[model samples]
Target: MSATFAGPITRSPHPASSASDRIHRLDIRDLDELSPDTTESHGEEGLTMRNQKEIRETSIRSARKLNIRELRALLGRCGMSVSDYDIEYVAALHGADGQPAYGASPHDGCGRPLPGNRGRPLILLSDLALADLETAVVTIYHEIAHHRSYRSVGHAGTEAAAERYGWRMYSEFVRQSA
Candidate 1:
């Protein structure tokens, strides 16, 4: 399936609407053509610096156009119920240990959860300017996975599970979009 972004983008508040339902999916193979220096690494393809920048810009534009309801719906698709949580787009994120990250979740070291939510998780998205659409979306899914893992199994094995969940969600999005 060829992924192509087409038509006028519209915002929908429906929880059933997913990224795959909205954005066109481009074939992963096609990404290489976008940059001459693209290469395969560690069994994964790497985009050139220029291509990365382009993807980031495009992602930012898409994210800015997405309304809060749409963002919430996207999270719902990832199996996260953020109806009570606060989702904020910020300049950047730092890990629980103070290192930068693409996204962070409630009290995970990126930042403190928003006050007054009564313990509902807070999802902090990095500024769109600093992340590609894929990274941003995946980060949201990743954080949600962390929330789920923490609740289900405690913190001992959250990272591996979250990483797997995030990548699986991302792959599905790509495949569905394609």
Candidate 2:
């Protein structure tokens, strides 16, 4: 089946701000700090995939318990901003009339430009309590990338862009964290 990454709802630029200015800004310094050093070893030499997965799962569980500020900091280090948005952790996402789904970005519903901050875009996350830390983290970045791509390229190319950008950023996060 084809995978669809949801895009963000577009909003009109505020009188005092332009669309370019509102686009999510990636912090280079944060990224720099998150980059893994090639000289360092994360003890991957003898671990099997299952062992590595267990370690990652443990890390994710610990991360979920982190406070909002800490969570934001982690995301920030991955070059994502949760500053202007409200994040909702849900059991699972449902389509219109509540159909089962994995995740979605509410802003991606239409191409119409919304009023400046008209509504809090739902960064809908599903099964956070059960998802692997890597999956949860990457999903968040993936959604934010959708917002960024929607702003930059509009709806037509959002999914592809989000996938490209999200995976790249997530990879960097994993490397640096490792």
Candidate 3:
């Protein structure tokens, strides 16, 4: 398959402030830092993926293989109205080339929301949790479930909400993939 990388998402900076229903949580962790290279080595040569940078770059290329439209459509299928900006931001954070340092905690695998940042809507995604298409859809839908919760209630009831809607999100993703 042909793969084209989109440089980086930080090329266009986001506004400092936005509505509660349209903000994105920036997860600065580098998914590229982790190595998943399994390329076979040649005889007597301890040659491997070589450097972590190469491994990370390869990972970024692999993640970029997902179609953006398909990702948006996947979210739409689950009833979440996400903007192109949100998708790009999520993709950037999950992809390579975005600034590293900021990360989503608790939900470190994906992205995280700002603490005490009430009335702010955020979607954080991470390759750690959603490494492939199936998990990607699952993770995005899970965040959307949270968005739905926020829409219904000014703020969501953490424990009950997660438990109630978590599996539904996972199932919906599996269904869509199937």
Find the candidate with the highest lDDT and give its number. Answer: 2
Roughly what TM-score does model 1 have, to 2 decimal places? 0.47
Best by TM-score: 2
**Would you list the clashing residue pairs of candidate 2?**
7-108, 8-107, 8-108, 9-107, 9-108, 11-114
What does candidate 1's lDDT look like per residue over 1-178, in tens digits?
A: 0111111112222233345432222223222222322122101111001011122334445334344457667656655445655666666544323333455554333223333244566666666413454555555555665454334433312333344445555665555445
Could you tell me how far off, in angstroms, the CA of residue 14 lies in candidate 1 after the best superposition?
28
Which residues of candidate 2, in runs, are more than 4 Å off?
1-70, 77-81, 95-99, 108-120, 128-130, 156-158
Worst 10 residues of 2 by lDDT: 45-54
- For 26-114, candidate 3 gives per-residue lDDT tens digits of 11221121222223211121110001112245344345455545777776775544552253233323222223311121211122332
Q: Ranking under lDDT, best-scoring first? A: 2, 1, 3
RMSD of 3: 16.9
Q: lDDT per prediction? A: 0.41, 0.42, 0.34
Q: Which residue pairs of candidate 1 clash? A: 3-25, 3-26, 25-177, 25-178, 95-109, 96-109
Candidate 3 regions with alpha-carbon error over 4 angstroms: 1-68, 75-85, 90-122
